[model samples]
Target: MRDRFLTGLIGYPIAHSAAPAMHEAAAAALGVRVHYQLIEVEGAGRDDLRAMLEGIRRLGFAGVNVTFPYKEAVVELLDDLAPDARAIGAVNTIVSDGARLVGHNTDATGFARAIAPLLASAPRGPIALIGAGGVGKAIAFALAGLGVGELRIFDADAARVARLAGQLAGRHPVRGVASIEAALDGATGVVNATPVGMLPSRDSPVPDSLLHPSMWVADAVYTPLWTPLLSAAKAKGAKVLTGRDLAIYAAADAFELFTTMMPSTDVMANAFDAVMAARYSPPA
Candidate 1:
């Protein structure tokens, strides 16, 4: 018997997401026929979102990936939340079982797995994280799991940063800083989870002079692969972790959740690299 085709991504402004490509490649490699689409729900009110969910249920989708603004919003619509998702107060992936909607958080696990090996060999020190939004919260929790001693969080929105700090206080020492420069001081690893260096403007969230050689920089923006934050980090001799790495790992996890089959990770990684390189390669 053939398994049902299923899974998709739900978010606004998903035109540049590499999720479809990565998931399609995994499905092809695993000999499963699956379909993953970008269901843009921007400007859609509550009723529209409800309708969309109903349509997905009717279509019998196994699951769907949520992103950005929708991560927190989708939680209210879910029937149950996975332990990790509940802890983080965010849901990046959702599994639909008949009429039950189960929410889960795979972003933190994926981020930690991708960067833990790199940090394992280095000396333990405090981490400086920029952007205190949904992705930032996930990364902060992941950092705690990775054994980070202290986290300095900075966000343009002071209230949001404070909220994130409060949430992480019991698990690890968290400090809410007023400026990015203050947060980066004596930091071992730096992370950018904001949209500053995403696509339209190639600008680093922090000044290059503030970055040191010993710091490790990770950006959460995958599109326009070499984000300004990463570029500056590379120039400063800081170990760089691209957002693409996170996407690859997260997509692999999502693939397993949606298909219940673990595809070749190496194949998926290689395919992701090839696709990204081709897309961003300089024109002749």
Candidate 2:
């Protein structure tokens, strides 16, 4: 394996992502070297994204993690897609084998690992999933892989919701609901796959009235790990899962793909904690 690896993460408005810290710490712990870059841009249309992917190839980056808006859009620009990426219809990680750019969806695997224990003794089926974009698709597929009896999905974008439901057709039990209430009704658990509770947005996607202590609630926004949604869920005595675990696991999976060596999740978690603390700390 190469001693030094150059990798990065591609996403929009990613001024605060802790991915670099997590990956670099993992590399150091494993006795390898890695330089992780943040390729963030604002208002990037399709053409701009194409140019960025071309730049990655030309710059000879080992691999990159795709997030948010780019995870789904980047799939078409890659030379090939791993089986899981194709199945999930999204790409969260991309690697270069010196010849081909292969897209993979580590979000699915990461989420599976992160949420597995939560579902181990709890109800796993008939869950409500908010948001239907890139990460949402990966989460839906992950839930399916975990043998979720059914997924009730809702998205503000009507067309996007339809697209996701269609993709999961024949593969698992999924249905696109008209509203958050529809998705949460009779559900045993709920997951917030949207960016509603992320930094700069303090709103909860689901109303507190809709939440119950019997349900387990999860949010995929880690910027403020304790999102408004999770807070409300906690207030209701519902078991909550933070986006922090998801972020760590996903980055660890990507790091392994880039370095061909698995990383210690505990070390990655420590790195993530340190970075998050610094990001929120006041300048001295």
Candidate 3:
């Protein structure tokens, strides 16, 4: 009999991740005896990563999802990096083949597909993006691939944003701005790629007064599901795309990558919806 397959997500502070439930449901639907684990390697440095890889090999695990600070760090340790992942400078999915670990990025493609329907009929214009970190790089490239006319980038680390702007310059009209106010002015769409509205910080990246009804908003943080930036966008009458969409889409991509099977999206969506409902439901 074939060894039961195992896969999981690796990150620090992964207590709140939905990946375990998502993958477990997919595995059940496929009739596969797959186990999804969340390995928390808090402050896991180079040596910790080496041990984790060895452990995965020892257990004969199929693959793992890399998140947050590990995305970029794991790349250096991988045996191979997919072209798109190399371009984005991040990897969210990894597959281990014996001693070889391959890194790939499905986040950009997944996110692009999730938001495609929303942008189908809207007027294409410049998008102002706040943040130039790992996820930001993926989102920026995804927007370019989706055919955005221009991109205005702003980050607290001005140098990083400028570097990303330079990398994306030829792809589209790229402008690096120092002020958030300048970045948001007359922008067709706004993306909050920063962790500003994430768990610990419930404050909106931009004040509600600054948001316009015509703008479209996308947030990459899903913990709270409806982030302050998204809330402000909804209040301003903007079409809102929550981080949950990205999470679901990325999970679907990972499911396919790990299982090589297309699980029913409707089933997965229903499972995710139920989980979200239970999570946000009021106390009895």
Candidate 4:
């Protein structure tokens, strides 16, 4: 490796993130050293985010993972956006390409890679996608790429769903539903992309009544891994997918993009699990 490199994540309430553990383990597996810092900013506005990105470039940091509310907003702050990021209208991984900061949407590719196996044997009927924000948009595009038959999307901000629907207009069959009930109606599976079930929050996007034994559930909140939404769905006998898979795959993709080094996803996955397990470990 060319000396030691620095990478990071930028998001609010990110104290629960496992990016550092996963990245560090992957680098160690490759005999390379890295420092993956978590840059947590609770209420950063556009100007604050711009300054942060500027600092990343000036400091010569490899790249950073953009998360939560900032992923969609950071698109305009970058010098250039990769084809996937531009198409999805979101950026989860931002790398410095020479002098320009280039944005990429690994969440889309990562979600697609993580969810494919789960959907293989499940019903091909319409799937319900909750939340149309940054991660939601990425998942929506990922579903389309997976060749899902139909997607019904719902978000509290109707305008966000409308824009996401518009983006996938000719690409896939998508409906911008008005209510969560409409989105989950007769769907094959449901994806909770909202931050409702994250740590310190017990809320779930869909009420327990909406979940049934036939539907498979996927939640994007991995801080707690076993989100309430996934729990409710599992209680109903629905096959559940954890946010951990998406987190690991997405982090691995970002690491490779930043360092041009292929990493062992298996090693990253082990690191992810160890961190999550330690969260509940009794302190000595």
* Pairs that clash in candidate 1: none
In candidate 1, stretches whose alpha carbon ends up further than 4 angstroms from where it belongs are: none
Determine which window of 10 residues in candidate 3 has minimal summed lDDT. Answer: 1-10
Q: How should the candidates be ordered by TM-score, best one leading? A: 4, 2, 1, 3
1-284: candidate 3 lDDT, tens digit per residue: 34256899888777778778777887788787668899987888998897897787677778898887688777788888888898888889988766777788878877898778878866788789998887888888898898886889999999989888978877878899998888888888888888788787888888788798888999988878899999888988998899877888888887777777777666667767777787878988
Arranged by lDDT with the best first, the candidates are 4, 2, 1, 3
Local distance difference test, each candidate: 0.84, 0.90, 0.83, 0.92
lDDT of 4 by residue, 1-284 (tens): 37567889999888888999999999999888889999999889999999999999999888899998799889999999999999999999999754789999999989998999999989889999999999999999999999997899999999999999999999999999999999999999999989999989999999999999988999988978888889889989999999988998998899999889988999999999999899966788
User: Model 4: residues >4 Å from true position, as ranges?
Assistant: 282-284
lDDT of 3: 0.83
Report model 1's TM-score to 2 decimal places.
Answer: 0.95
| Local accuracy of candidate 2 as per-residue lDDT tens digits, 1-284 | 57899999888778889998899999999899899999987777889988888777878788888887788888888899999999878898999876679999888888999999999878755999999989999999999889977899999999999999999999899999999999999899999999998989999999999999899999999989899999999999999999989999999999989989999999999999998888887899
**Highest lDDT model number:** 4
In TM-score terms, which candidate is top?
4
lDDT for predicted candidate 2 compared with the true structure? 0.90
**Per-model TM-score versus the true fold:** 0.95, 0.96, 0.94, 0.98
lDDT of 4 at 145: 92
